[model samples]
Target: MEAAVNDQPRRGDTEGFVLQVRKIGNSVGLILPKELVARANLREGDRLHVAELADGSLQLSARDPHFAKGMESAGKAIRRYRNALAELAK
Candidate 1:
C-alpha cells in the first residue's frame, strides 16, 4: 500500500501521513517511502527510536537524546578511570 500525505493540519500544528501497516511474517510494520527516509537522513540498518506523545501520536527519530546523554556520561567515566580499568584488565 502507498502512503498518502494529508495537507490538512492535524492535532494543532502537525501534518499527517496515512500509512498502511502490513504483516511481515509474524510482525506488522509500515513501509516508509524512500523520499521520506532520505529526508529524515535514515538508511538501512540504522536504529530508530519510537515514542508515543501525550496526545497518543507516534514519533520516530534517528537519534535518542537520552541514550546520547547516557553515552556521554559513560565516556567521561571511562576516561576518568582509564588507568584503573587498564590495571584491572591485566
Candidate 2:
C-alpha cells in the first residue's frame, strides 16, 4: 500500500490493489477495487468527478458545488428555451 497521509487512514489502500485500465469507447477506464466502493458509499452507475492536479496526478471526488452552479445555468437555459419547447411540442 502507498504511504498513508495525515492522521486518517483511507480504506482503499490498506493493501494496495492493482487497477487494470481498459479501453471503453474512445476513453480508457480504471476498475476500482470493490472495497473502495463500500468505503466511499458509491454504487454502480454513480457519477464521479475527476480533477487534474498540478503534479499531473488525477483526483477523484464526489459531487462538488460547481455542479450546483452548472445545474443553475441549465435551469436558466431551460427557462430561456421554454417558448421554443412549447412551440415544438405544439
Candidate 3:
C-alpha cells in the first residue's frame, strides 16, 4: 500500500517533503512540485539565480537584486547626463 500525501504549503519547508537530487543524464537536479512552481511563478525554461548567504544558506530567485539595483543606478546616471554621454560617444 502507498502512503497518503498532502498537497499543502506550510511555514517550514522540505521537512516531510524532501526533494531528492538525482543524476539527470550528465547533471544532477531536483524536481519541484507543480504547486510550488505555480506559487513561485516559475516556468520550465525560466532562468533562476542562486546566491549563497553569509549564514551558508542558499537563495533562489528569478533575477538578481544586486544586478538589478546596479542597472537602475546606471539608467539614472545616463538619463541625468544624456548630453555628456552622447558627446563622448561621438
Candidate 4:
C-alpha cells in the first residue's frame, strides 16, 4: 500500500487520509501503509505503543524509553535469580 503525502501542504494542515477498520478473524485492525511504516522505521512483529492525546488524537511510537528501562531492570533481576525463579515455579 503506497501513500503519497502532498509535498506542499502548509504546517498544521489536517490533510490526512482516512483508513478503514477491517476485521481480522475475531479482532479488528487498521492496515498502515508501507510508506508510513518505513518512515517510522517499524518492521513486522515490532511493538508499538499507542496513546490517546487530550484532543482525542492517537499517537503511535516504536520505542518507549521508560518501558525499555523497566524491562532491562527486570531482565537483570531475572538473570540474577534464575535458580530461585525456577525453584519457585516448581
Candidate 5:
C-alpha cells in the first residue's frame, strides 16, 4: 500500500494506510496489507520493536536489543522446557 499523507507530526516514516484492528483469539490485532509489508521489508511472523518517545509519540521498527537477547535466551529455554511443553500437549 502507498503511504498516506497528512498533517500529523511524525518521524522518519511516511504515514501509510490504516489497518483495522480485529480479534485474534483473546487478543486484538491489525492486519497490514501485503504491499505495505513488502515496502516495510517485513514478512509473516517477523517481530517488531516498538517504543514510546519522550514526546508521547510511538515508534515502530525491526531493530531491537532486547529482542536479540531474548532470542538467545529462547534457545536455552526451549531445551529446558521441551519436556514440560511436550508433556503439556498430551
Candidate 6:
C-alpha cells in the first residue's frame, strides 16, 4: 500500500491500487484493502465480472459491460427480424 493522503487513505497517488495475486490453498486470489472493500460495497458472495481489453489489460467490475451491449444488439435483431423469425418458427 502506498502512502495515504490527508484524512483519507487511498490506494495510491494515481488513484490506482497495485495489487499482488497470492496463492490461497489451490486457488489464487488478491486481497483488497478494507478501505476499498468498504468503498465498493462488495460482499463475499457478490459476483464480479472480468473483461480482457484489446490492450491486454484486464478489468474487473460488478457488471458485465459486454452483456448490456449484447442485449441491446439482440433487441435490435429481434425487432428487425420478428416477422421472419415468427414464420420460421411456424
lDDT: which candidate is best? 6
Every model's TM-score: 0.57, 0.49, 0.61, 0.54, 0.50, 0.59
Comparison by TM-score, 2 against 4, better one: 4
Count of backbone collisions within predicted model 5 = 1
lDDT of 6 by residue, 16-57 (tens): 776666666787877777777788889888888888899999
The sequence of per-residue lDDT tens digits that candidate 3 reaches over residues 1-90 is 222355333335644345556566787876677777888899999988898999998777998788999999999999999999999999
Model 1 misplacement above 4 A:
1-16, 71-90
lDDT of 4 by residue, 1-90 (tens): 323544222223464545656666787876776666788888899988888899999977898867899999999999999999999999
Model 5: how far is 18 from its true place, Å?
1.7
How large is the C-alpha RMSD of every model relative to the true structure?
6.0, 9.0, 5.6, 8.3, 10.4, 6.1
Ranking by lDDT: 6, 1, 3, 4, 2, 5
Against the true structure, whose TM-score is highest? 3
lDDT of 2 at 86: 89
Residue 79, model 5, lDDT: 92
lDDT scores of the candidates, listed in order: 0.76, 0.73, 0.75, 0.75, 0.73, 0.77
Query: Residues 1-90, candidate 1, lDDT per residue (tens digit)?
Result: 433554322232456455567666788877676667788888888888998999998888899979899999999999999999999999
**Residue 13 error, candidate 6, Å:** 4.1
Off by over 4 Å in 2: 1-17, 25-27, 68-90
Q: Model 4, stretches more than 4 Å misplaced?
A: 1-16, 68-90
What is candidate 4's CA lDDT for residue 58? 92
Angstrom error at residue 70, model 4: 6.5
Backbone collision count in every prediction? 0, 0, 0, 0, 1, 0
Best of the two (3, 4) by lDDT: 3
